[model samples]
Target: MIHVLVTQAGHLEETSKQCCKMSETTSKHTSALCTMQSLHLVLLVVLTIFVYYVSKPHVTEVQPMNRFDVTNVSYTVSMAQPTDSIQRTAVSERTYVMVMSQKRSGSSFMGELFNQNPTVFFMFEPLRSLTSLAMKKTSFSFETAVHNTLNSIFKCELTHVPVSGWVVKKTEVSTCFNAFEMQNNSVLRQICSKYDLTGNQMFLNISSTLCKRRSHFAFKTIRITDLAHLKPFFVNDEFNIKVIHLVRDPRAVMNSRHLLHEENLDFIRRKGTHADEVKDLCQNMKVNIAYGQHIPDWLVGRYKLVRYEDLAEKPFQVTSDIYNYLGWILPQEVNTWILRNTDHDDDKAYSRTRDSRKTAQAWRKTMPFPDVLNIQNKCQDVMKLLGYVQFESRQSMRDAKSSCIPFNGYLNHI
Candidate 1:
């Protein structure tokens, strides 16, 4: 009887051992399967995000502050000839004011506006690399030359300068930088410097202009990308410049983009100088955003958010505001000049030629679906900050616009 009991006990032990082994194997297998599923799910999510960001169009904020490191210079000057306008060369009393901006953001136009000031003489993107070449200066630092020229132009401390026709006395982006000649003027630098000062300090000790009453000296430039990458050389005297932020709706901006090359990127690629301009404009905007974190706030008010539409609608007021902001006299001549040459009077031309306030909102029809979605996806942060909406479809856009409400108060605050 005792031997029978022992055998039964051994059989029971074997069965229990087999059951425990099966349970352990099942748990291991289930856990392995769950982990595999989790990994696949994670990969799918990562791929989706990557696709969204990559396929989207890029957008950057329209920041107009912190341009032209004016350490010791004023913008007041004297000029009688309209031909002496800033379209020729950038000038200041003692330094150059490099007006850095996107290509078609009207940086040159602003230079023209200041050039026409009775008290200011601003040359358009003067001191360009091509300009240096045309002047036969071997290895010229346009940044340095502008500093020397502005010191002389505004040293007299004059006011209310007159601006007329543009002069080709200078080298332009379009004139020199072209293909087939094996030339590449792709880099246009707008570095402003002043004598008797190091660019390290942000203070502009303008004893010359400060001592003179109603005296101003200034120069203007446009281009801010390469400098952004090389931010280590930021000097208040030579590089710290003020900015005038010119902003419009992304939709309107997109329209202007289309008008620039008929909205055809391919056409621009095949075209002449416009191709470079188009490329430069987009590149600059992207660089500006990437460096947004380092930009200072003083440059904010330095940015007078001028809407192209508002400028056209109230050229007189806008012109006056710009002059006032510059601490210069507002002359009747500028008003007359704007009236005669600008599209302020003609609503039809304004609408047709991309000058109307409503033109920006018109992008719902103009911008292609892919582009529209791309912008919406990539530039939402900036677009929302600027009070623009991402349209999902036609019905949604109409509903939003009809409300007459801007999301971020992003219009003509200047």
Candidate 2:
């Protein structure tokens, strides 16, 4: 009976051992399945994140305002209701003036007439960067590019200007205070300080704030050959565009260009002989004057044809006339500047530093008699139309200076 009892006890111990082994195997399988499920969940989460990022829309670095189409359509900016304090501060009304001219036509000097005004924010030769930008986008015409750039500037949409080493170089940003006439401007300085413009940022990028308070936004350009290229802007109700078609006597223009080794003279010389060049210049002057004369009746009041000579010879009178035409009261600061700049001593050389009136007739004494006669012959009819009297002899040249009458035909028509 004792032997049987001991055997049964051993059998019970074996059963117990088998149960323990089975339990261990079950735990091992459960752990392995949990690990596999965990790994699959982690992989699914990673794939979801990856897919989200990959499927997202790409944001282009270039602004849409930089792109221009050739269609004769007007662009209108819809005024958004100001939701922010910053946007609400923008001026409700602004005037845009384009001082258009050919090279060596005293456009820069004329541009400064507007620039000296504290209310005016002037940009010089903004189109000089268009060539570089145009090379990248061959689909758009050069005129279209210019139009787009001007639109951006006029609307104070700086980001719209091509900022990738095309418009506003890094060096220009550093020296902008002087270049943009912001040295003495407290408001602009304060804005610059607030933004902490480090010259590394694009000029157009900062101009938004700089131009915020300005009533007049003026820019000078020599790239526009035809006034018709700007017709779209004129039709756009958003833009109150006043165009100053600054002209100079073709003889003086030619002489100044020749003396300064300007590109206009170089281009002409490359194309033809001296006489042919003068004749071409005469033809261009006539065409430009005709364009000015035949400006659309709607634009007659908006367009003003001002002779550089007239502006130089009679600074105050001419400036007053321009201001009156634009319906702007000439600021005291601008008047002071005009007086200071125009009252300097006469310098014979091609320079901005000279008596304004003397500078008007400097080309007469310097230009050779044969060249003078050639220019006179080519330009005679237009010159007469413009009220510029030709000299009969070298002695009469000096006498003709005091007697030279200013053109009032446009004034009468206007």
Candidate 3:
């Protein structure tokens, strides 16, 4: 009986030891599971953070604002010439304006609206010199030249601008030298600094001096085909840039081009009154207008799209609004200029002054019916977008003297 009792006690002790081993195994498994769950939770959090950052829109570095009393500041103008006007002002913030458009889009006329302002230093087709340079395959790439030249010009570094870009009258300088040639030959760079307008240093010095004194700078260009090309300037706060994207009706633009015997265009590889020409023109317009509509953060207040038709219909009203946008009053001189220019009709090919309202409607009366339809068919989407009315019949288009363009608030809002 005693041996049997001892054997029972030993069995019970072995069973307790086995039970402890099972408990320990279960505890280890529970610890591993908890560790894996914690790791998965940490990974999930990291992945979410990565996605959030990746999806956010990129923001450029913003310029520091100059805090000053607005009540004390005022914009003043000193008219230099009918062509050249310089503004002298107590305002610290310099305004840089660009009138961007395609050729024969009445850009020259539209530019006059800003150019007439005494408080503004304006250049006409500065990039036209660059276009001249592009034909020669100069040292600077087209993009580089455009960016550098504009950067220098806006900052009043006139010497850095291509000498060809400057408007020194042929009669003004007795000893003539080709600045474009000097630029291409690198003769100016070797003689002076890299960006010396060495052909006539005096004119360069004078223009630069006058430019530096101005509170505002404006330039018009038909060279820039894409709004995306100006992204660098838009992103840079130093520029304080305002873009006036001037767009005209494709049919009118084509008619003007054809009338001038402009068989070749800078943007088109081969140009004629064809599907390719109108298609390319409208496509360029569409891209520019689209960019203006869906403007990015950097371009928020800096960009505006101006329609030629609207400006022609009411030059004074539109010009006044433009001046107001620039935080300046429309001077009496600008109004006078507008009055003189818009009221009179001129036969000259490149005349800035014209019966502006009549000029806008000339296409309807002169352009061949088939040609108008061709443009309308090619640019149907752009026409719809810009609120241009397409004529269903030749008689309707030619006979109607009143404005065909409806007031599209979406396109021409101040």
Best by lDDT: 3
lDDT sort, best first: 3, 2, 1
lDDT tens digits, residue span 148-169, model 2 = 8887777677566665322334
Clashing pairs in 3: 87-119, 344-355
CA-lDDT, candidates in order = 0.42, 0.64, 0.68
The numbered model that scores best in TM-score is 3
lDDT string, candidate 3, 260-362, tens digits: 9855446542243454777888988998888766877877887788788888888887777777777777778788888888888768887877888888878
Better of 1 and 3 by TM-score: 3
What are the models' TM-scores?
Answer: 0.44, 0.67, 0.69
Clash total of candidate 3: 2
Instruction: Give the least accurate 10-residue stretch of model 1, judged by summed lDDT.
Output: 180-189
TM-score of 2: 0.67
Model 3, poorest ten-residue lDDT window? 73-82
lDDT of 1 at 223: 29
